[model samples]
Target: MIYNTLSGRIEEFKPLEEGVVKLYTCGPTVYDYAHIGNFRSYVAEDLLKRFLKFLGYRVIHVMNITDVDDKTIAGARAEGISLKGFTAKYEKAFFEDIETLRLDKADYYPKATEHVEDMIKIIQGLLEKGYAYEKEGSIYFRISSFPEYGKLSKIKKEELKAGIRIDADEYEKEDVRDFALWKAKKPGEPSWPAPFGEGRPGWHIECSAMSMKYLGPTIDIHARGVDNIFPHHENEIAQSEAYTGKQFVRYWFHVQHLIVNGEKMSKSKGNFYTLRDLLSMGFSPRAIRYLLLTTHYRKVLNFTFDALYQATASLKRITDFLFELETRNFSDGQTEEARNMIEKTKKDFTAALLDDLNISGAIAAIFEMIHWGNKAMEGEKLKKKDAEQIKLLFYDLDRVLAILPEKIIEELPDEIMELIKKREEARKNRDFATADAIRDELFKKGIILEDTKEGTRWKIIKT
Candidate 1:
């Protein structure tokens, strides 16, 4: 089950096509570097994709790169470059950022500039269907024509003050809320030859055009940030259904914002931190990904330096468990109790995720297994088969979590290994000061050691 923003409730997920899920996510406007708050939605969308695949569904995901919005136009103008050249630089950086955070690439990354023809076609259909009108060379979707205008966001026309709002991209519209389907060509701005008479596509119409061109008229799921629930998504529904005369989307997955220190993250607030900023602060990509994904998508993620440090520690625990399972010497036999615990953990993990993609609950189940495994390790030694089962379970869980390190890290340098050995000997010889010094030196070299009852195991901490 997953929460549907349109329905305002959690509904059982049933794809229109059997065993296939068509997901459309709103991508970023490539005007500047994407901040951590922006990635909170992207990471949640990635989790949604991975979880669906885990449930044996073939997903066709499409994300749009908004390269021609008002912000992008201004950014290009400010840089004294062509609109294409300006957006291209940020587009390249955006993809690199996604890769750095381990997000899965969408099947199609449709750009607004490339789909102007599709937007023109949809606008023409709306004009003919009497759902839209032209005013001063700009086409606008007449909100009064669509009686169910506020259904998705539960905003009522009566509550809206009668006024004129002319924002082509991101703003609230009331008093019939007629939004632009196509903007009139402006001086020194990128414009395309269209039936709408040499104008650019509006922000709301870009998704409708690109989504319909690739995913078809009706998409199975549409995921975005909660801020889009108003003018943006609301207008999308009005214009899309007006053009296609069918439901625009089945499920709407909206993620909440990422907060910094109990306030909404904003540059003006002096709380904005981009991925590069976090990385420069010595936070690992894995730890940042873990921090971004650990909370439920619907809840506000409160990000802090302390929270990031804790996430680093938590990820270390999981990595330590993996290392222990990899190197332990055990005989080939399975304890029935251990087997039962493993099976139960897998079931609980699946059940939790099935319940509205409850990832936090699923993580709890993993920790339960980890706790049991630690206790069992202290008693009767785990057989080789039992160790493999635990490892396999972790691999299965990591498929959806994706927070685990993907590779077995290479061995530390011989000097670093010797230092670790020296630290172990120092502790054995009751020389606490020497042991502490060796540990600090290794820490500076990006190696962290945990003293388990089995022995001293070290993990390479990515700075």
Candidate 2:
């Protein structure tokens, strides 16, 4: 089950088509570099997509890159470059960070600028349907025509009818209650020619047009940050459903805002941070992703340096357990109970995630598995087959968590292998001084030696 933002309750999820899911996740605006707060939502969305695929659903994910919004226009003007040219560098930076964060690539990333014709067609349809009005050179969605404008936002019609929020959106329209569908061309900003006007599509219309073009008019899932629940998403629902005469979205998933240092992150307060900022300070990207994944998306995440350090420690504990298990000597016979426990833990983890993405429950299940493995090993009851079973389960779980280290250890260099062999001999002959010297030499060469009950197993230190 997943929480439906529209219904404000947990509901069973079923796709329009069996064994298939259409997911639309709101992406970055590309006006500037995305911060950790923005990535909080992306990480949550990625987890959901991965979990869906793991459950045997073929997910067709669509993320829109909003490159032609008000922010982009102002940023382009500030940089004295063409709109696309200015946004290109930041968009490139955004994708580079996406790779660093290990987010799964969406099937389609529809940019708003490339789909003006699509937006115009939707706007024209609304106009023909009497759900919209044209004034001067601009078109606006008539809120009065669509009585269910505030369904998703829980905003009352009386509140909007009281006095419109002009500055929050375009104000050239007839009523403050109505939002812009198409804006009139301004002197410096970019514009697109339409039958209604010569201005670009409003921000809300862009999603409706692009999502319908790729997915159908009705989609299975629509996700974004909590701040978008109102105004942006609410506007999309108003225009989209009003034009199509059907439901626009089935599940509305929204991630709560992220706070930093026990307060809301702000540029003026000097608490704002981008992903590069954390990496430049020598924090691992794995740790960053782990921290973001621990908290439920519905809860506000208070990110701090101390928390990130703790995240690194937690991850190291998991990896160290795996490494020890891999290198240790085990008995010949397999433990049947251990295999059953692995299956149970896997089921528990999946159940927790399916229950509205309860990350804490899933994390507890992982630690429980680790605790069991350690207890079995301490009792000398863990067999080679049991250890292998536990490791396989973790690898499967990592497909959704993605918090473990990605590098697979490969063959060691000849010199390193020779040193390892010499160290083993030194230890066997009780040559303590030579073994210590060899270990120190290999440590300097970026290989770490862990002496297990079976033998000395060396790991390559990752920079």
Give the whole-model CA lDDT for all candidates, comma-separated.
0.88, 0.90
| Each model's total of backbone clashes | 0, 0
| Residue 188's lDDT in candidate 1 | 93
1-463 in candidate 1: lDDT tens per residue? 9999998999999999999999999999999999999999999999999999988999999999999988999998998999999999999999999999999889999999998988999999999999988877788888899999999999996676556445554243333467888888989988999876988999999999998999999989999999999989999999999888899999999999999999988889999999999988888998999998989999999999999999998888887777777877777898998899999998999999899878888889998988888777767567889989999999987888888787645578888888888989999999999999988888887777878777888877763
Considering every candidate listed, which one attains the maximal lDDT?
2
TM-score per candidate, chains pooled: 0.93, 0.93
Which pairs in model 2 have colliding backbones? Answer: none
lDDT of 2 by residue, 180-244 (tens): 88988988889999888699888899999999999999999999999999889999999999989
**What's the lDDT for residue 388 in model 1?**
92
Least well predicted 10-residue stretch by lDDT in candidate 2 = 163-172
